[model samples]
Target: MGLLMFYEYLSRIEALIEKHDDIGLHNYLDAMHAADIAEVLENLESDEQRQVFGLLTDEKATEVLEELNSDDFSELIKALTYEKKVTLLDLMSQDDIVDKLNELPESRQKEIIAFLDYEDAADVKDLLLYEEDTAGGIMTKDYVSIQKDYSIYYAIETLRAIAPDAETIYYIYVVDDAERLVGVISLRELIIASPNRSVESVMNENVITVNINDDQEEVARIVSKYDLLAVPVVDNGNVMHGIITIDDVLDVIEEEATEDIYKFAGTSDEEVYEHDDTLFDRVKNSVRSRLPWLVITIFGGLLSAKVLASYQTTISANASLAMFMPLLAGMGGNVGTQSSTITVRNIATHMIEGADILRTLIHEISVGMLVGMFCAIIVGTAALFMHAEYHIAIIVGISMCANMVTAATIGTIVPLIFKRIGVDPAVASAPFITTTIDLTGLTIYFTLATMMIANL
Candidate 1:
């Protein structure tokens, strides 16, 4: 919805709430989509949010519950009566229910599970065993699978019986008598084939699968690469456990993207999830995440200062050399940050590693040199116009070009090194990159200035 239009609806909801118009509020909510309702709930006060949520029909309530952020979901569910919670959980998807239950205390998880049906409870418990970042954690048990010996007619009949409850019925898996995944057949293929054909004959055996222990990101990569609607999760023995749908992959992508964004900004995504917390806790989280980077930057600042002090004699010989120091440092930091962003993005997309790493580094540095040379010409001319001295112009231009080259080299290499060391490449963030570049840029500038002192 448009911002202004949403605010209008919000205003009307607020007005309705004040007047205690339950019927009107329920009618208004029915007209809005679940996602939109979730947004409205976010803007409302806690008590008001509860009141508004209470008005939603069971189906709408379950949909809205899935749409809410984790914090909101937990808080709202905790506020509801036990019976109400069970009703909503019953309507929600199995994966979504597990996600909500995972956010609650263990006692609460057990309490909710006890209220759920036997199979649903068992599925939730089984899914909870995997690490949250793994493929099994996100996979849903709600998928269609049939015995390999089953005929196409049996498969079609089974799909009809289970299709409504299954998260995805497009790709039907075929398993052996031991329940080991053997092959897969698409819905279209099954429909057109002869009714008497066995699943083993029609199903493709070259099934692309992900290990249950595989990282969620790898699962997303496979799903994207193969253009799969869903991928089967299996144990070492190839016994299929569950299926990861595209919707789950989408959630993982969004989460990883958000986490990377926070990391690049020299912080953790914890702060975002804690946005509703008290002011002090927020500040503490901010310092905890950012202080390490700031410490590194402070150390870099000291080293740069030491470099400047060592070149005091050269600096005093020509104050104009010091004048262009900011230009050199600024250009270097800018180029380095640009290079870092590109490398990090490529790494996130699984494009740069091994031989690709060296190629990316060389390409970025070469591009940086060409860019520096172009900027050097402009700056050198500007220096001549500003200082009207060949020595000053020559020193500044050379330093600028050299600084840019070093910046790109450091920027590209540092992230790759971090990745190799099993650290998140995004932790080689802009602040760290720019700080290191500035320190090196100063050394390059001052060294050139020292060399030019005789002429000055």
Candidate 2:
């Protein structure tokens, strides 16, 4: 349905729930997709969310809970009764089950674990052992696999038996006698091929797999780079453990994007709209993320102050120099930030490798020089019009050109340096780049001002 129609439908559902005060309203809400239901719940107040969620069937509740963001998921979990929580946990997939458990307190997790079925409990425990941002944590153990010795007919029959629980049936894995992943076959191939054909004969042996300990970001990169639907996970023994589906990789991509944005804005990785967090808790999370950058900016400001102080006598003699200082610094900062952002993004996407780093830096420096020369002409002409001394205009022009070159070089280099040191370039780039530009711009401006004005 169109968005307008969906909104109208939700409005009608809200009115119906208010008017009827019955189970029919609950049934009407349950019939919608989980994503749609999540949207509806998000629009409601906290108390209203609790009330609506309480009325949902356990299955519907599980679907909606998974669809919600982490903050909303925590709130929903808190709102649910102990029995309802157990029911929701039982209904969710193993990966989701572990996610919810990790979000809860240790005592709550222990209590929930006691109620889980042995198989599910074991899977959850195994998943919890891996880092939250690793391949093992994101992969689902539920997938259709068969021995390579099995004929197409046998594989199809086996798949049909377990299709209900599998996350996807697009790719069927073929395992050797040792239960090692040997090959992969698509559902389309299975349906087209003769029934008697052995899986080993038909399957593609050049299977792409990842180690269970691989970083989730690396997993997402591989999936996106190869345009893969799913990637197999293997242990040290090369035994197939689980598969990471495209949907899970998409979640990783989103999480990475959110993290990058937060780092860019000098915020923490925690949810910004946490419902139960106290004001102090919120402040603590935000402050910790922001303070380091603020500290760095302070040092940058200090450097600018020192540079200006060194040229105080010259600036006092020639007032025009002070007017252009702000303009020069601002432009340099803008150019630096732009270069840093581009380089960081390229590195993150794996488009730029370590080997290409020097070449990229040199290219950026050359581009900066060209841009600086153009900006210098404009600023110099403006300075000439504003000031009587031709030497002062030339000083301003030379400083502008030098500042731009410095800005671009520092901007491009900072991110590369961070990446080499195993730091996320995005997180380290912005504040440092701006700070470097500010300091360098001021130094250039003041030195030029001192040279021209002192001579005059």
Candidate 3:
């Protein structure tokens, strides 16, 4: 619905609730998507949120809970009675239950876990042992698996019995007696195969799987690379654990991309502020996110000042050199930022591997050389037009070319070095790159002025 339409619905909802019209409230909410219902609940006051949420059927409640953010989901569940909370928890997927419980306080998490059946509780507890950003943590325990030796008829029968509880039936995993995943077969294959055929006969033996401890980003990369709907997670012995579905991988992609964007802007945490947040809240969060980066930037400025201070004699002798300093640094920083962003993106997307780094660096340097030559001619001509001395114009031209080449080389190498050392390439963000370029570009420009200016 449009904003005005949603507000209209919200007013009607509040009116019905005030009248204690349970039937009217349920009828109104039941027709909306879970996401729309979540949007409405988020706009409501705490008490109103609870009242509107309470009107949802048990199944609809589960759907809405899944659609809500971590904070909103926790708040909604916390408002429920103990029995009602447990009932909702029981209806959720194992991964969702673990995620929700993790958001709660330690004591509350224990209390909620106690309400689960022994098996479901054990599964959730085991899932909790994995890091939140790992493949094991995101994978769901609900999937269809069949013994490799089983006949097609038996597999079909087995699927009929377990399909209701499985998260996906598109790909059926083939396991051994020990529940180690050995192959994978599509449901389409199973349906077309003769009843007498063994699952092992049709299953693809070259199954692609991820280790439980693999990073979620790596999991996403694998799923995306193979165009898979789901990839199975396994232990050291290849024992089947769970499957990471495409939907979860899509979430990981969005989260990682957002994180990279924030880091590029010098923000620390990965939060994207909502439009509905209060002004004070946004200001507070904005300060919290940007303060550390600003502190670093402040120090960088002081360092640049110190560099300028050291060149006092050089600038005092040749005022024209000072005039050109900003131009040199500005061009270098712009070029460096461009190179670093491309390198970081290529690394993150796996387009450039370790073996490809050397070639990539060479290509960047070649482009840098071409860019530097073009910029040098333009800047030198501009300096001459501004009535600068011939020697000063020549020095500015040479400095611009040298700075651009150096800046581009540094930008290309820094991200590769960070990745080689197992750090996120995005940590060498735009702000950081620009600062480095500024200091180096200034130093290079002054040193060239000292050498090339005849009066100096």
Candidate 4:
């Protein structure tokens, strides 16, 4: 539908909701797709949402429920009957059910799990053995798999019989008798292969897989890097756990990106999402989350003041140095922030391993040196134009170069240390980097000025 037409359709539904026209609303929503109905439900008030949801058939409700965001899904579930909740949960995919269940209390989780059918209950229990952030936690066991010894004809026929129940049949994985992942074959390959040929012959034996314990973000990275539709999950022994599809990876990508963005700002997602539903409460939560980081910055600023106080003898002789202090500090702070952001992002993508970390460190330092030289000339010229003394201009220029190089070096090393110590680089890097660079940048500029001006 056109944008205007869709909103108009939504308006009509909301109008019906206002009028309490249940029959009309039910009839109207019946004609819309489940996803559209889900969108409509999200836009409605809680009472209105439950009213509309109550009108949906079980099958349609299952589809609509799957599409709702986590917060909305949890709220909606709270208003359902125990039987209705179990029925809908039973209709969901094993991985999706586990995801929703994880958000509930431990007692509630067990109660819900107990109501699931035997096989699904077993799958949920098995999947729960892995932490929620790991590959096994997000992977689904519903993908099609073929025995490597099966003939092409049998494999194709097997897929035809099982494809309806499978999450994705784009690539059918091949496992040996030991249930070990040995190969993978695309749907097109299966169709074109000679019927007499075995599944092992045409299947690509070099399978790209994630270990069951691998982090969900790592799984997303592998999927994105390889342009894969689905990647198999295996144990250290090569036994199959399940397959993680592209759809699940999309959620992981968004979660990781949101987390990194928040951490870069010196806060977290929980401070934002885990709050009472009020404008004032949210504002308070956000302020609380940021206060500690800002407090640290305040202390750093005080230390900088102390550093400047000790250099009064130097600044008194060359007051022009005070003017360029901001220029040097700003340049260093900006460069450090840029370098640290890149390092954290690369770490998230698993690209900064043993030698790559050193390569990244050196590469950033080299860039910093070149960039510092370019900025040094500009700032020096500006200092001269401002009619500052020649020595002051020269001192600021040299300090800018040194500070920039040091800023980049610290930015690279700080995140690496955080990662080495098993700390989340994103969560811990930015505030520390910003505070360190600001303190040291001023020290470098003024210390150099102190030494240079003394000789003059």
| Most TM-score-accurate candidate | 1
Tell how far residue 161 is off in model 1, in angstroms.
1.2
TM-score for all models, in order of appearance? 0.95, 0.91, 0.91, 0.89
| Per-candidate count of clashing residue pairs (backbone under 3 Å) | 0, 0, 0, 0
Ranking by lDDT: 1, 3, 4, 2
lDDT of 2 by residue, 247-314 (tens): 88998999998888778766658637455579988888878878988898899888878878887888
Tens-place lDDT per residue, model 4, 237-284, is 999989998989999999889988988889878575532368877888
Model 4, residue pairs in steric clash: none
| Clash pairs (backbone) in predicted model 3 | none
Which candidate has the highest lDDT of all?
1
Give the higher-lDDT candidate: 1 or 2: 1
The whole-model lDDT of each prediction reads 0.89, 0.83, 0.87, 0.87
Please, what are the lDDT tens digits per residue for candidate 3 over residues 1-456?
Answer: 689978887888889989999898999999888878888787788899898999899999998898776668878887888888888877888877777767677787777788777878898889888898999989889889999999999999999999887878999999999999999999999999999999999999999999999999999999999999999999999999999889889988998888888888788552466546788887888898888778887888889999999988989988878888878888898889888999999998899986789888988888888899999999999999999998888889888998999889989999999998998889887777888888888888887788776454
Q: What local lDDT does model 4 show for residue 43?
A: 74
Clashes of 1: 0
User: Could you tell me which 10 consecutive residues in candidate 4 have the lowest summed lDDT?
Assistant: 268-277
Weakest ten-residue segment in model 1 by summed lDDT:
268-277
Q: Could you tell me how far off, in angstroms, the CA of residue 417 lies in candidate 2 after the best superposition?
A: 0.8
Residue pairs clashing, model 1 = none
Runs with alpha carbons beyond 4 Å of true place in candidate 4: 1-10, 20-36, 57-59, 74-87, 274-284
